[model samples]
Target: MASSPLGRPTRGTTGTNRLRRNDRWIAASAAFRRADDPLVVDLGYGASGVTAFELTARLRRTRADAEVRGLEIDPVRVATADAQLAEVRAGRTPFPRDLRVSFARGGFEVPLADGRRPAVIRAMNVLRQYDEEDVAAAWRTMATRLAPDGLLVEGTCDEIGRVASWVDVRPDGSPLRFTISLRLAGLEHPSIVAERLPKALIHRNVPGERIHALLTDLDREWDRAASLSTFGATQRFLATVSALREQGWPVLGGRTRWRLGELTLPWEAVAPVAGP
Candidate 1:
């Protein structure tokens, strides 16, 4: 059952391109690649709509016909985002569709204007305020609203978007992959991500939990690969992730993403947190 819960309104502390890492990942993803109808939703996109506008611009590079919509529960926020996107409708934003990007007032149920399903729902920081126990049903509620090949990239990141971790969820409401993206240079430990983990894993970082063990192992491998830092943080991260895979960890994504300070593991590696 969908929790009879509407997430509390956030502080709306937003800025331009704050969700760039996740946007880039989605734009180049397998789902977006095969999508016939490329509509994206920036759910609860805070006080400013700049991130929604930025998502449209980023996704268009791969699929020029792509469109992005920013959804918010606040009617006032919807009004503001709509007005900002109106510039594109006026042919002033150098964007494709006249109203390619629009805003609507809706909660997690996604009250679309004309009954539309989105290809991707990038709900960044939306779940941070909810109780940890509410994360799964919330995921199920949003995933049901996706197009057949849709994706739900739900996760959290810091204010400037430097460090982020998200789970790529499918229509079945099951997570396919877990990605931890960080600015490699000064990245002390991969486990630091536990602090910024989505509402799902944030509380699961304590001892005896799968997430804790995962981070502990990552920190160990990072230390084991420390000597490789002279080649650059990217190289060190690549080596660290490679080591994890060799040690029988279920790390899934490969070198291309590792070089970007991202490590993707199968959902099972972190699934115990959500287990009874």
Candidate 2:
């Protein structure tokens, strides 16, 4: 018969909208927007398939033909998601009865049939359980299955979806960028994302590490922009990010994105000092 799925099971902890930030990111990404096939995979989607359902809803806003496949290594989790999907199909759930989504049993290998390659594979919180040393290999395995212009988004986020960080890897398995997205309302320091860094960089958030330095600089700029808090958190975050760009932090995107409490930089800016 077939071999078992290629990765460990998740903690099975997930909540509604826990991945909303990530879904928006992917919806806006060039890989998804420009994909010829527009097929996306939600790898290791936990005990529920809601994330995949939510992802399809958001993506369809940009590409009506966008499709999402939720893959879980645990067959039981797949069955549960299939059941939930059935409810959705029967119009018993809030999701669109015609929502283009499916559930399957798979892992980092991202097993698509008929030699099909996905345009994007989102593996949020999936690698957190793997050792840091196992990250590169996993990235290669997953990235290899993507379309030539596809992307692999791997990262971690808090349960409520407020704090998040991820690495964008190309189909060749080379990481392209690192991003941190947070909720600015009632906020604290931006370095709070340190706790939720992807497995590749989580342990590298120490002194002398690039990721550590980035967080340190972010916290400093956030404090420097404290006076702007009177204008509101979004304004304050805009100033903080602008200050980082002025300091040559190589921040990506513009005010529109900064206002959403996002900061993106080349992977080289925060790649581990030694390696992932």
Candidate 3:
């Protein structure tokens, strides 16, 4: 298929399991697990198809019939992923059961053929290279490719996939929630995740903005909950989240999510400001 040109090409810096956190969260999300067709799009999956493959494997556990498509603006990266998948298939070496993973050349506009709108379009690290002003445009372009009930998971993360933050967007292109996930074992501060809270929220993590206020509160709460560190950082995190809840920050989810080093808040809490 002809690749799109809505967005610029990227360096395609991909590594094995670099998107594991986003994959795990996507599979667990209601938008993905109960999709009408279980079709997912892995937008800008870098130079390899491994992340797309992993996304299929993890999502299949919940949907059982999940399919994944990795979209890259660069035709070369798409071809490279296709070659990797072919090599794996040719080997027949007991690979992770991926009945549905494909590579397509596309961009933020997602020029998918057959009118095949995916139920989930996960655009990880795709907007990092663009100006902060371009995020909403990118989100609009991506969300337009979704099914009526589709979701758009857009975010950024570190190299090794230890920490990530994404915004769950509805088909109408409005962001629903913001989530922050961390490695958590020896975590220093829960607010450290502010650095990875998707491109939209990263620079907005300063004074006055809602995201900034949220992080400031989180950092304060983390310090207050440090007493619980005697038990473990996980416990301290839980306490901090609980405190946020008490503060009535419209925090969503609970211990079930907190245990995974995750904290979710509604979109209004972190939407970008009007101007400088």
Q: Which candidate is the best by lDDT?
A: 2
Q: How close to the true structure is residue 4 of candidate 2, measured as C-alpha lDDT? A: 70
Q: After superposition, how far is residue 112 of candidate 2 from its true place, in Å?
A: 0.7
Local lDDT at 14 for model 1: 93
lDDT of model 3, residue 234: 89
Runs with alpha carbons beyond 4 Å of true place in candidate 3:
92-94
lDDT tens string, model 2, 69-174? Answer: 9998888899999999999999998899999999888888888888889999999998898899999999999999999999999999999999999999999899
Cα lDDT, all candidates: 0.82, 0.92, 0.83
Candidate 1 stretches with Cα past 4 Å from truth are 1-6, 87-99, 273-276
lDDT-best of 1 and 2:
2
What lDDT tens digits, residue by residue, belong to model 1 across residues 1-276? Answer: 112325666678797667888888998797787788888988889998888888888888888788887878777787887787777677776554443677777668865656678889888899998887788888988899899889999999988888899988998888878888888888898887887898888888888888888899899999999999899988888888888888888887678878878888878888765441
Reference-based TM-score of each model: 0.92, 0.98, 0.94
RMSD per candidate (Å) reads: 3.0, 1.0, 1.8
State in Å the error of residue 166, model 2. 0.4
Higher-scoring candidate on TM-score, 1 or 2: 2
